[model samples]
Target: MIHSLDPAPSAQAAMLDGATPLTQLGVIRVEGEDAAAFLHGQLTQDFSLLGLSEARLAAFCSAKGRMLASFVGFKRAHDDILLVCNRDLLAPTLKRLSMFVLRAKARLSDASENFQVFGLAGGGVPAALPTAVWSQWRDGQVSVVRLPAAPGAVRALWVAPVGAAAPTATALAEPLWQWLEVQSGVAMLSQPVVESFVPQMLNYESVGGVNFKKGCYPGQEVVARSQFRGTLKRRAYVVHAEGALVAGQDVFSEGDPDQPCGTVVEVAPHPVQGFDAIVSLQTSAAAAGGLRAGSVSGPHLTLLPLPYSLLEDI
Candidate 1:
């Protein structure tokens, strides 16, 4: 909950432009001739498909196939690529990435302070770049819709000169970010949730975070196997609870001692009643219902529908 902004308006015609904490968020700058090609081989997404106007969600993994970090990747006007992830893990994640950059032409640096980030939700997003000169990747602004049908929202970062005017679009309350994130089924991975879920566990493959046809990275073997071999045991699911929740909180099925079922991925202040979070649980426990966080006697978790369907065996 570390924010750099004051508050502003809610609904508007254009964008939800204002400084939002970005709280646990951090950014990494990658620039160079080999930046795109180099990262394509090291990360989960198909970097070759990314352009200045489109952003991609991707993950960095350990050689054993566990995720080291997950990020929302996008390109700036220049040749630079921006990797955004949870703030607390950025420094170490950067160092880890640096170790592998021995001969690559790309450079990685923290760029959190240099960027203006915001979350937009609701009916529709407007066309053009609010008040900032930052480029637009979507048709207008893009936010998640969770009405009759669920839609995946966009978490946008606009990189502009350091003291420029903030966007004139209406500012939304921070909880809207949590609400939209849950609705989109796009779970943010934190330090606690690190190395916990493989890409498919979080539905990364269904969401374009994994590219099987792409070459090798740290844990490609395990990731590819999980996708095509019918061996995935856990998957991401949206869950709502009647109490406080957090990342890494262990979830349990009724009477299941010694064997815990799942882990909480993201939790936020509920836009409505209690608290809502995203959890990755074994298909067994998830299907059994009665999933609780912390212990079998812990807060009750009610599963909700995810925005997208699973692409298992794909």
Candidate 2:
């Protein structure tokens, strides 16, 4: 459904070409015999489903079932799995993952700089991928087709080895990626916000980030409870703030100073307008509308519909 936005080959290539590789993003490689087995039991998604040409979105959580980080997980080879997350969480996350691989036949290493990550908006990909890939699409083929975040904002990826030549495209800055994240409703986990959310609170299941049927992970119990128990008090939603927003900032309802009704998950300057953010809040506070942080008179926030829907049952 996604086609190349450029009518001209040169224009398209120019949009694709760049001195600083526009397609390549920071990456980390986790390789070892036990890589898949180890990750299968540690992440929110099913690692057994990963393939050389496929990708997934998964979460790292604390043993108590609190979300520590979220990532675009994919496989480069039978032994290599890639975890793409926020730059700020790289070192610590890598260190943490490495800690658990002591005896397992797995090796975790940071590969952020070795590969380039690009966002190809619109459809120009060949038909070798999923017709509807809602999450990360890690491909290395020429003119590869990738799934988009949404129908309106079709995005593909073109990743290559370091020093790889680009296809000659305008080098849009990284902010564009962040903008897409906000608009697409992809809530990323950041440093101060680690261990703050369970997968359900962020709509991870609907987005293909959580696999309920999968064996088990750190926060499996709590996450399962939040879903099957029908006791989910919090859910992530798109929101906007009049003032600068920070992740982990408390969100209040009716200006009440009680247990924060919610917390900011992700925020970014709108590409063409005001600011945009994702907030996870208690379902009760969400129905009432008006929510603020520091003070009722301070920053007022407006709620926006998420790109995807939360399943009714769970």
Candidate 3:
């Protein structure tokens, strides 16, 4: 059985109210008449029909169907869309996406400097905000996107021009926001694990990141086959370890220490002690338990219940 741990009292209280600057994230702005169509053809989600009030959690994948980057994207106007992703991967991701723009009339640019991003949790969330995950609310120059919440905490992404007034809530430590991110069970793509997975492996399909009905994209065929043919053998799960864990670390199963069974996708210090991570593991290995992080003799890991349900293979 999976074991769950309670947050430390101090941590729980801190999570109840605060906002943290998301210095680790960056923004990509896509503008022009063909922006939506261009992105629709290259990403895992359908941007062609995106509505201003809705945000999409999408993936950009390589031709082999390995995800290169994941994004929280929303339309700012009919021809303008903003994609928020890991700052470390923004330059390359933007360059790759731009390569396909060719004569499509779409323009992709790094707009990180033009905007500020913050993570709002619990009481830090603005009084008036969208309650549904992936929904967006805009007031003049500021935009707020509701994110999947962590247990006991409501979360949202706050974005605005670089010098805009910050959220009024108490300042939250970045480490706490990092912990809540892992607690949310949604792993954002980063340089360390780029091309390490397809969207489904991270439960992106279940979290509204993939659109199977959409037309062709870089890895659309492979992604579809994995879904319809039931060929997906790995999935992301939350795991806790008494020792620190880092992204890109390998995980092993005690039953078969000779072979690695998983890869750590994201990790953060646990609110109480040790660390928590989102790791993608072979489904069979995950069921077998006895997982260890870093190496065969590394720290023991305890499986934690996923915050959300995995959709049955469609």
Candidate 4:
């Protein structure tokens, strides 16, 4: 079992903690002669220039620009790419992606059964892996990608063939890993909230999930308009709330309880508090007053500091 590195608090402590099985995530593999060329025309990132040593945070959007799914994608080989996303959306996401492959030589498959994903935090790499965010290294059939971590902490995603040798290092508890994921402020895409927000609404552009200069994809025009027009009125923010907060849950401002001011994009149980969540809401509402989840008398939410700056003026 994994253990904590320091006896501090919960959310922060988890980042400096050990490893855990990322059972909540799933993987999709796209391989063939046209993999790179095909994905370049679909996702929001510049996959054509994605080097073997690097990974990207990308979003697959609908024609209307709403994000269908978000992924931490990396190339396994010159013609192979792996996309990691929430398990619940894998099957449908794969199916939808396949439909667009029409004549491309690329093939999409649910590689979840063939691979086991794990999250490692506050620990040293396996000697064969790199320690920088988005950098990748390989050990046999297992590929490890250094992922963005909380401030002053280290984290990585380990993906290996199901039957391959598992990392012998101790792991952090799964709950702790989930909590840290929310605390990091990178909202995760789940089935309940699919096709909800545009990439910018989730702060994707600021976090390297969107490449504005890249060629067109599904909702390229809409995404471009939002950025260049400066008409985006909503953004994702970090908040702490009492009671259970879940993805797709509504957030309302006390000033106007009749209408929802935001939606809970991602949430997790906090070690010291009831729950921590990344909420996407109107900027004005977030700045006005404290938000409540569920109803007017529902649990009140307090906005917390986001680890990164938003691209509001862009």
Best by TM-score: 3
Tell me model 4's lDDT, rounded to 2 decimals.
0.83
Model 2, residue 103: distance off in Å is: 2.6
Candidates' lDDT values, in order?
0.70, 0.70, 0.90, 0.83
Candidate 4 per-residue lDDT over residues 1-314, each given as its tens digit: 11232235555544456768888899999999899888899999999999988898999999999999999998889898999999999998999999999999998999998889988777634656676667888776778888766654567888988898777767677877777677677887998789889998899998889999899999999999988886679999888877899889998999998999889998888765588888999999988976899887989988887776776644
Return the lDDT, model 2, position 29. Answer: 79
Instruction: Residues 247-314, candidate 3: write the lDDT tens digits.
Output: 99999999999989999999998766799899999999999999999888998888888888888834
What's the lDDT of the predicted structure labeled candidate 3?
0.90
Report the alpha-carbon TM-score of model 2 versus the true structure: 0.84
Q: For candidate 2, write residues 163-189 as lDDT tens digits.
A: 766545445556555655665776878
Model 2 per-residue lDDT at 259 = 58
Model 3 collision count: 0
TM-score-based ranking: 3, 4, 2, 1
How does model 1 fare in lDDT? Answer: 0.70
**Clashing residue pairs, backbone N/CA/C < 3 A, model 3:** none
User: Candidate 1, residues 191-221: lDDT per residue as tens digits?
Assistant: 8988997888898887767888888888999
Candidate 1 regions with alpha-carbon error over 4 angstroms: 1-21, 128-159
In angstroms, the error of model 4 at 50 is: 0.9
The 10-residue segment with the lowest total lDDT in model 3: 1-10
Q: TM-score per candidate, in order?
A: 0.84, 0.84, 0.96, 0.92
